[model samples]
Target: MDIKSFIDSTYLKTAAQAGLDENQNQEVLKTFVNEAIQEGFKLIMIRPEMVSLARKIVLDTSAKLLIGTVIDFPSGNSTIETKLNEASQAITEGADELDFVCNYEAFINGEIDLVKSEILKGTQLALANNKIIKWIIEVAALTDQQIIQLSALIKNVVLTHFSEADYNAVFVKSSTGFYKTANNEPNGATIQSIIMMLENASPLPVKAAGGVRTYEDAVAMIQLGVKRIGTSSAKEIVHRRHNQNEY
Candidate 1:
């Protein structure tokens, strides 16, 4: 398959405005997401609150509406119950997919079981509802060893996929832009670490987000066997398309 087809975008208008009220930004997202999907973008990740809106707009058409909000958001400190409840709400509102963040503190603090339970529960939630799950192993906040270990442990995930359990689709995401100025370098090593893990997991897919805001970056990620890319700049990438040039 062509790598470009793997490009999946994550978007939230409230997320776009640093200080806008949730209600106002909801309108902004409605406009932005509706326009983007109408322009032929297939898979899109939206916030949970906007899931019903996004779903109402895209469910009858070819564009696929997938919901992917932060469980603990930029941080991963929220309890598993909170995350699971959020996932349940999203699915109830019509989420076709899920993008969740692992508790970085838990992972760093050696609470490996806690992290696993949350992620595994997310997988189960999505699976039970016939949705696809992509665990955001945010590679940005982790050390090399942590990255390697996280990848290895999560590689055994038995979530939904095209083939067998081994043939998975884990998304090794980068920063959620929670800390754009974070010290963890989102360099080649981050990508390499995720790629390494994806390879180790047979047919798993990596999703490179944060800091990847250009066509070149998207293309590079595609070449790396990434089946779905999470980017907030979908419009920027498709801005020059003659067909999509109107908006």
Candidate 2:
């Protein structure tokens, strides 16, 4: 399946929250970057601050890896200007892709215009800089109907404002892997959610992020036509496939 091509090896944890100081965090990021280079993963997703480091690690390598970072990360509550500013910095630092957390909270609150405006501005920002953009819908936080509506909404905005060729440059991603459910429900991508997203978000690609921890799980998502798989377990999944091929 050439799984390496489908993986977006990810590490977006904060150093302080992970109980590591700055030095330790850098070391960890170095290791993550090195691993991505060695395994030939599609892209390496890291925090905005580490884009340059990841970019540098693969700059000399023969592997053609892409550098990706999150914008408005776990929460999509930030102002449009703030997201654009952060995205501009990451692009200048060598980020090839930007996964934006859409303001789903605002969408649910009937601020539909704001949500649409946010995505429109963010997508335009990335496209202008020649960087790919993925809109993270954070499906775990919404109902089935909301998911469908939001997916269609994002598609509508891109199609309405941009040319057809530009559609592929943007993606509808599932989950930030950081949204907390009010009732303690599991967060991130689920089979049901992925199915719903794929069915609704057409013309634009789909990226299934979060909760994809095993090789089989990832393969299942790919079979469902996901253009990319976002997970911190990318290395493990690829290694597991290698091990199985040996037997």
Candidate 3:
């Protein structure tokens, strides 16, 4: 498979999060965007503030790399209006995709209506702007049953409110690659979780983010039917695949 096309070359950390100054962080982001363009990855997933810069860099090149930004990232507790505002701003700044952290906490807390409403609103906004949307379910924070239920919930929302042509544009992504788990457990996409998501979120598509390292891991996810793999180690994964092919 052309693994590079399945990769969303990602760098979502902020200046504070990466323990670097603003200028230093911008330099890092610039390098990341340049490298992604050079490598011919499908997309560059970045923070909202960097969307304009990334868009500018990509435009300077002939690469068809899509620019994606997270909305209400890591935490999915933002109000529906807040999430929409953030998504709108990202779109205005030239983002081609918006990966919103879904309100899993509210869903687990029995606020089903609230979660459903946000999904509907968020999906609507993205489709209206002709952009792709993915709902990050943050799998590590939930139980197995919760994962299945939540994945199905997102699929239901999209299938019910949107047309079949729009199904490909909406995805049920696995994680934010930012959620913390107790005892340093796997805090990202696991084989089991991906299976659950794929089985339940079919027709809507699934993007396995987080904990997906190594070329083998990426291939495994793709084999199991994940449409995209989100990772900070995209270049390394591609290199590993090349080395394996040479041997």
The numbered model that scores best in TM-score is: 3
TM-score of the candidate numbered 2? Answer: 0.97
Ten-residue segment with the worst summed lDDT in candidate 3? Answer: 56-65
Ten-residue stretch with the least lDDT total in model 2: 54-63
Runs off by more than 4 Å, candidate 1 = 1-4, 13-17, 59-68, 157-166, 180-190, 239-247
Model 1 residue 41 CA deviation in Å: 1.1
**Candidate structures ordered by TM-score, highest first:** 3, 2, 1
Task: Report the candidate with higher lDDT, 1 versus 3.
Answer: 3
TM-score of each: 0.82, 0.97, 0.98
On residues 216-235, what C-alpha lDDT tens digit does candidate 1 reach at each position?
Answer: 67776677766677777776
Give per-residue lDDT, candidate 2, residue 36: 83
- Candidate models: Cα lDDT each: 0.65, 0.92, 0.94
List the pairs of residues colliding in candidate 2: none
In angstroms, how far off is 3's CA in candidate 1? Answer: 6.1
lDDT ranking, best first: 3, 2, 1
RMSD (CA, angstroms), candidate 3: 0.8
